[model samples]
Target: MQKAVQLEVYGRVQGVGFRWMTKLVADKLGIKGTVANQADGSVKIIAIGESATLQQFIGAVKASPSPSGHVTKLIQTELADVSLCRKFSVVG
Candidate 1:
């Protein structure tokens, strides 16, 4: 079954190619959603895909962040409603 998740990644995530890297990972994993920078200096990612794939993607994001990015805290929540997106992209 397809699942959706909202991820709030904290720490030095902005201005460090985090969004770009997230896009790349999402595309590679065949996931669809949007990644954006939050006003609270965190990165927010809404991803939709198979449960296993989403887990892998989230693992990647936490285990391997952008070169200059350091993910200090990661908050994940399963979204009950899925918003299907055409493709994964970086959003404002």
Candidate 2:
């Protein structure tokens, strides 16, 4: 089944390569969505893909942090409407 989720990653996520790394992970996982730095110093990710793939992608994101980034918390919320993104991207 296809699924979409909104994730808020907290702690030392901004100012690092978090968004870029996330995009790379998403691409590798064949997921589509956007990753951006939030004003509150969090990294926001909206990903759409297979349910199992999404779970793996999320785990990868949490486990693999950027060299300068540290993930302290991850909050995930399921989205009812998938964005049907064509590709993963790093957005500002």
Winning candidate number (lDDT): 1
lDDT of 2 at 81: 83
lDDT of 2 by residue, 6-47 (tens): 999998888788888888888888999999888899888999
Clashing pairs in 1: none
User: How do the predictions measure up, each by TM-score?
Assistant: 0.94, 0.93
Instruction: Give the Å shift of residue 73 in candidate 2.
Output: 0.8
Model 1 lDDT per residue over 18-41, tens place: 999989999999999999999999
In model 1, the Cα lDDT at residue 76 comes to 97
Worst 10 residues of 1 by lDDT: 60-69
- List ranges where model 2 is wrong by over 4 Å: none
